[model samples]
Target chain A: MKIKPECATCIIRQIVDISIEVTDDEIEQFRLVKGCMPVINEEYHNNAVPAWMGTVIHRHFKKISNCEDPYKRLKETANDTAQNYIEDVENKIKNSDNELDRLKKCVLATIAGNSIDFGPFSISEDIVPMIEHTLNSELKIDCSKELLEDLKSAKKVLYICDNAGEIVFDILLIKMIKKYVNDINDIVVAVKGKPILNDATMEDAENLKINEFAKVITTGSDIIGIILEECSEEFLKEFEQADLIIAKGMGNFESLTEYNLNHKKLYYILKAKCDPVAEFIGVDLKDSVLLSNKQLQKNLANIDKN
Target chain B: MKIKPECATCIIRQIVDISIEVTDDEIEQFRLVKGCMPVINEEYHNNAVPAWMGTVIHRHFKKISNCEDPYKRLKETANDTAQNYIEDVENKIKNSDNELDRLKKCVLATIAGNSIDFGPFSISEDIVPMIEHTLNSELKIDCSKELLEDLKSAKKVLYICDNAGEIVFDILLIKMIKKYVNDINDIVVAVKGKPILNDATMEDAENLKINEFAKVITTGSDIIGIILEECSEEFLKEFEQADLIIAKGMGNFESLTEYNLNHKKLYYILKAKCDPVAEFIGVDLKDSVLLSNKQLQKNLANIDKN
Candidate 1:
């Protein structure tokens, strides 16, 4: 979860890209990339988390450009794009033979939606094809059966959403979980408190009516994933209390894995897009993963005892 | 070639790669990338040339790693790899029906050899398949016949060498120029004075017996391409005096094109491997370019007149 040496280049590449997007003035673009180099120089280290560094650099970029949300339009477009695929995903999940099949299909659809990423790595911007690809592709790290078993005892399920367009598909999964996992007393969806890339915000979740399926909350800060310290006390209580947490996207995997949160149920659902994440997850780049952070959680359990 | 914003990432990526390669020590890798950030921060700009910044940062890397010629093993491997392909290339040229076919084959084979690159961009290190690929590919901008016509009246030629392995193929092109273009009085093969990447040094040129084909000299500077100011007075004099300049590889294309050199006959013969260089040549990426700097040369002529 710590930033790789390669992350230095990728993060800078993103800075350059966003800087260009934030302005037409070449001098301004130059100034933005120029100014952010010090931030990267200061923060890019072995122990720093990539997404944590991303937040630092992106905040610096926004301060310089006077852009409140660089990816605002993209998030809107992504929401619209994913809107078209919802019915298709619903139909595919409905076609499942049994509850497990239906649930797995929903998970796959959500993982497919994770492809609508604007991270340092390139993925297919075209949505439905990726939907089709993900549905057909087997998860590289499947723990859906374990997820199903955990649902049996779970009182609260917290779903952390990633990108906006993809959040539409996530809505499908939430609906499926609610309909079938009837024992679950609560379903909570957490979105970003502020805009970062295409990551869904409260406004986006509200526009999508994510509250129709579950209680919606923000991470309470605009850092990537759940940096526990940055989260609101209310959100942290929910994070601590949740029996099963469904975390979407690479950013969460990157940010959350840094802590030894023992006995916490964290499910990382994403497509392995970059070398660092893929290598850490022991999967090929671009492979779909529905991974239980059970291993980390259990390992930390023993570490805590020792 | 003014540095693209993307170049910031790429150059840093190169730094990270070299830092890792230079030392197995993780802390050292961190330190090396860490130490070089200031240099990148200080020099990376819209106006800076990528290769020139490469020189600056690489010098900084060399200083930190306390390593000389980080790519020395790869260079040796490249030379050995290319040595195996020379006979095959020579045979292909020999099978040509006429002078134009033979000469063009030589150029194509030479361009194919340029694929043995270890820059930030990924290229197939496999030599012969690229040789086959290049031979099959047409010059996106063909001026081989023009090169032949120019050769008829040329007094001296300066053949700038690129990577170590590719210099093996350059030897063949130099031989063809010598044999067919008999009116040429001199042929000078210029290589790097010190090692940078796999760029041919005098040691590599000498090892490959390039002296058998033409007189060999160093650029008098280890910097990428022809930084005319940094280059030795002797090499700069040769650069100015040579009637036809056949520059090999992207580095030469990057560094040499910054000058006005209004009347100079500079043929940039290489594969257009990156976006900036490809755009400048008006060719697609990975296209073979036997590009005459005629447009650049003539455009500057108008400016000079003004």
Candidate 2:
């Protein structure tokens, strides 16, 4: 999606959030924000995607603020908070009588986990309420029925995780998927190689004991979302080989939406955070979306035929 | 006061406001905001004053948007809304039994008018409720008694106006001042040389029929506030010669506060809208302040001595 006029303010707001997170020294915060203005002015373009712009702005922010990971403390807090909800989520799935019903509940839990972002606007310390809200609310775009069909036949599943605390919920979803799919060995969970915002890394996977369920690997870049050219060859090979891709969060949705994946089936599960992204996906702000790329392509093809 | 980290976001937000105001075309709005990123990045400094930064950003917004006066329609609306309150304000002064009480009421009315701003944050269409709110609220920094004392002895008063609709209230205050201090000829109302933001200019003065009371002159610059270096020699002469000065709004407060005015008695009457300005002046956000240069200088000198 193209960058909106609102993105400029959103980017600055993110810098402000980071600056405040890094230091209590108001002078230092001011200097950090001032440093970001030039980078935004030089790099911001109407046609540019937010993830691409975010990558550039965040790079400048880290260098100028002298804080390699401004969201480190916040990420830790999010993970700790999210860890508390793991038992409840696991119980929600286990209590379900039917396998398909359990899988659907797991999908909702995974989408709920995507809410724990440490970006500029999101300052919520507790994800329990947010998770509850997501669980209770109906999805704006539910492609879960089709997704379930895809999951039944999928040989390899690539589950791309979003945030730190949210990873625990992803694990719950993975466990459910293992029941229906070939095995845990066939599923590969992709995390960020390095720290960027609150995105989960290999350390988070290790901390959450994700290795017990499915093999965890890194995307080999600190970019907020998956940028194909920046990814490691090993991750790219896994991405190419996967029959079904479950991309989590708005960051991945923004980065991977425009790409021609050569008929690979991808399902985007996220809460539309900003207006631009919401508008791009034809959903309202704060709507939980479960969209299938194959279905979207078919709809577009039908429109072209008309 | 020095620009805070919060100001970076606020400045970009102002750009967004202008971009939306100038054109309905979302693409053009996006382009306009993208253009401002560099100017903000390159020019924003922690040590810089907000008014100085605002001046730069507004100038950039106008240039990029190709709209010379972005707030023209909003200014007209503000003036029209404020004009409706003139009768009520006049009644407020008339109903007061004593001259001093009437003058105090006029001061409140003028401060209330200052609320009619077309800046990034303010989008309220009605000033009646705002006027009522201001009238009922107490000033955070009540230097009104000192201001009245200074007006008693002053020969020439330089009244610097802020926004459009707010000018009507200034006229009311000027009328009250004229009744006590001197004739309208002795009082000169200073406005912006050209259109910038919703700042009152000679055109606004003419639109509101300000000539009925006092002589309105241009400050010889389109900057958000009174930048003395950018002003014409005529305005500087008037600024230097005035016995007492009444500066309205936060814009003037920001730009004029740091200057060494050689012990000139200047009264600032403004609502503390933003956090940094409010914090600098030792008032809570949204609190109305009536502060004098003499009191401010005394406090600073005491701090220096300590």
Candidate 3:
């Protein structure tokens, strides 16, 4: 599951090469961007693909020494890089800062809106189905009565969220939780604050309207983990006190696994979106479905009745 | 320079797309690899490109989702995606344990065995001169006799290095210095340890043979920086005591600039590989090559005479 260094460079080269196809001029622009480098050698790809793709063209052009007709190669690379970049941008916009949100908006508008209208781009037009599937697969939960009971008795809940493109789903889930729960004050939604390339920063969480629903907090770390390396002591204290933590997406799963909270309640809700994570959880990576804390969901109903 | 989230994503996309183009089996292999995923966007371009091309074929795949060849479109997207995957691999390689030492062996083997291949990529033969020119221009230095005299008075020197691709050049430069200075014991080369995605880790430094001629130390951080974020305080204290500190690459430059060194000795050596760093140092981005402390080089001369 670990990445080889050669493969890492190869991926970067491919990203860079593709960007050149779109426009080599952007290569320099991309090289200057921080956090554009991808995460490597882990069980899951997580943030690796998108972070490297966004500004990869320039490096490719430079690598090829700026060929006279780099379009074919550039175009080829762009498709690969753009797919990952879009995922990452969406994640950042949903979970981190305004700048990223704005940039994501601009980029989406360009690719899905303007660029598609004028040039050759193969992006899907209707994203709703994907959204639905992502939610169904990535955000499904066990809605049994026992689960509801556990929810009622839970002292605190932590919601760890994912991609900007998918934030609407998260918001909807939060609203649903509010309707079911009596004390909304006990819920905490954690989001990104500062931008570190494509990773969700604290600023991203604010824009997604996640802050409006609960106690929103930002941990300064670029990677999603529960270690408190980037999160302040206060945040860590809050995390420790929470009765339940619902982590969404692959990044959080990758970094937080080390914590393995035995004393506290926890739930991992996500689509087997990436391979390494799925492998870790012993699930099919391509299941195209959702999984929840089946036992917890059952328990919640019992607790709620009491 | 900090990367804008959208731009970063875009670059990643570009790389992912290109990777798919390299091979068809790689696609299935990629899926098998950790973190790989198929494009699940609802707007799958089925009609844009031809199917025979598998993932790499293009004409069938238009840039538009509505294009005629869905297969080609998918292939192009795969190509872009491949790039992203490659980066993931490279990051792992760079962050591998004892990367510097490993790299040293690789480079040495390549140079000695005349197997200087960057994988299957032969590159445009012209890229070599361009890269050479870039390194030469960016790393240029003009040391004065007076500056050499000043440095010769110092007791030690510390070299903080950058990427694996460029470490060979650094080694060459180090050898040049040893020829002139008799106090080889004073030289210390610091590299990164463990893996941190895109940054040059301590493993990379060791692989590159930085430990052979100088005292090698690994900063635990994934990226290169001067403040020693991951290194122990004892290491920091030693770094502070060095008569000269030669920092290589843009990462170190960015992290080191904010420090208040007072009258302490420092030497920043790097190629203005990107624009912002060039602007920061008042150089042109297109001008390739690396630079070093002009005065510090001259200062070493007086030590030889003494």
Candidate 4:
């Protein structure tokens, strides 16, 4: 989707926040933030993608501050916090009444785990208590049933991940799908090539042991989401071959449609973190959605007809 | 005060808000907002005064939108809202036992009346119940007693007005002051030369019959706050001559300090609407402050020493 004027303020806020996170010296903070103003001047407009603009400015922030990952500490904490719940999640899945129930629980956890994101919190937001919270709160757009049906006949599944801590749950989710849906033979997981706002890097995927379940590849750039031009030939090949694509986080939800992979069933699983995104998605702000790209098209068509 | 990095986002939000307020046509709204991005590009910096930058952007918005007053309806509604409460405020002041109490009530009413501002709300927020609410809410940094003392010795008072609706209560504030302070001979009310935001204009003052209470003058340009460079020599003379300058609203509170009028006993009376301004004033957000410019100098000096 094209950027709203609201995105201009929101991106600047993110830039200023990371500037503060990277430095304590008020003069340095001012310099760091002031220097990045030109990025917004260049990138904010009607035609720019919000995530694409967010990527450019955050990359600029990384350059000016001489910081590889401003969200390093937060990402580590998010990872540690999520990793702590692995055994409990495993136990919960095993205790479920049936494989269908287990699959639903796993899917729900992956979506809910997104809330333990750096975009919202400065530190680790414990996801242990959140398991119960997710169970009680229904997805605003529930497509888990349809997702399972799509998975039943699929030979390959591509899982694109979001944040550091959230990726661990996604790995566990992949395991459940592999076990339950026997037809899903091949699975490819995608993480960012480098750090961009606490997004999972190759190092995070390695640390989390994601390759034990599925072949993990990098998106080849530190962009905010899946901006196709910024991706590698290797990632593009997998994106083309995949039968079903499961995209996580608002960042991926924002950028995935740009690639036109709707012919291949693409399910967007996220907690809409912003107004414009949520409003576009036909949900309330912070609503958890497991929506297909086909559903996105249908929703847009309905809105147009209205 | 120099602009904070956060101010960039805030100014953009203001620009976008007025764009929406000015027109319903989506393409025109986008055009109006996009056309003004260069203003922020030119004006945003560490050393630039926020109100000055604010002035530049809003003026740019006015020019691009081709609408002289985007807030005309809102301003009229605000004035009407405050005008409805004049009799009740008058009766409350008269029924008070002593002149000192009546003076305090009038001062509180002027400060409280500013909440009927455009910056916070889209529509008119009634100020009737606000009178009692104002009486109950204590000032965060009150110099009202000192203000009354200063008014007693001064033969001249320049009440730099803020918004359209709030000026109605301020006119009544002047009437009460003229009655109680026998030494007060000349009372001059300063308003914007043109409509800026929802700030009071010459026409508003004329319509509200402000001339019956005090000589109404304009600051010569439609700037957000007092930009000394933007003011005419005629208004500058009055600014120089006034013994006690009672500046209302956050706009005047922000700009009056820029004029180096600390020696002139300038009293700032308004609710600190945003965090950065409140932080500078050593108060919490939304706290009503009746502070002195000398106090601002003291606060900065102490910070430098610390």
Q: Each candidate's DockQ score against the native complex?
A: 0.72, 0.55, 0.03, 0.40
User: How do the residues B1-306 of candidate 1 rate in per-residue lDDT, one tens digit apiece?
Assistant: 787766777788788887777778777788889899999989988899877888888877877788879888778888888888878878888899988887788899899889888774543234557667897788888888889888777888989988888888888789877864444448888999988866889999878777876888999978977788899988988888899999998888888888876578889898987777776666787899887888555544676687
lDDT of 2 by residue, A1-306 (tens): 567877887888888888888999988887888777777776677778888888888988888877777788888988887778878878877888786677678888887887788663546345567778987687888888888898889899999999888887888888766665677767999999888878899988999888888878999998878899999998999898899999999888888876986488899888887778887777888788888987667655776687
Candidate that would win on DockQ: 1
Interface RMSD (Å), every candidate: 1.2, 1.7, 11.0, 2.1
Candidate 3 lDDT over residue span B157-185, tens digit each: 77676544445445654553444445666
Model 1 residue pairs with clashes:
A78-A165
**Tens-digit lDDT string for candidate 1 (A215-298):** 889999888777898899878987887888989998898988888764787788999888888877777888998888986455
Candidate 3 lDDT, A1-306, residue by residue in tens:
232212433344343334433454543434422212322223124333332222233233434444323233322333333344444434534653443333223222222211211011122233434433332232123222333455567777777654443333455445545554456667877765433212334444555556677777765443333435557665787688777666665445445555435555565554544344454455574333223455534444565676
Number of the top lDDT candidate: 2
- How well docked is model 4, in DockQ terms? 0.40
Q: Give the TM-score of each candidate.
A: 0.93, 0.86, 0.34, 0.87
Q: In candidate 4, what are the lDDT values of residues B1-306, reduced to their tens digit?
A: 676666765776676677777777766776876788777778877778777777788888888888899889878888888877778777777776776677667777776678787664434244456555775577878777787788788867878899888888887678865654444337888899988888999999999877876778899999887987889897898888888888898888777666666578788888777777888788897787888777778888998899
- The lDDT-based order of candidates, best leading, equals 2, 1, 4, 3
Candidate lDDT values, in order: 0.81, 0.82, 0.42, 0.78
Q: What tens-digit string does per-residue lDDT give for candidate 2 at B106-191?
A: 87888888888866354534456777898777787888788888888989888999998889889988876776556776788999
The CA lDDT at B73 in model 4 is 86
For all candidates listed, what's the TM-score of chain B alone? Answer: 0.92, 0.94, 0.52, 0.91
DockQ of 3: 0.03
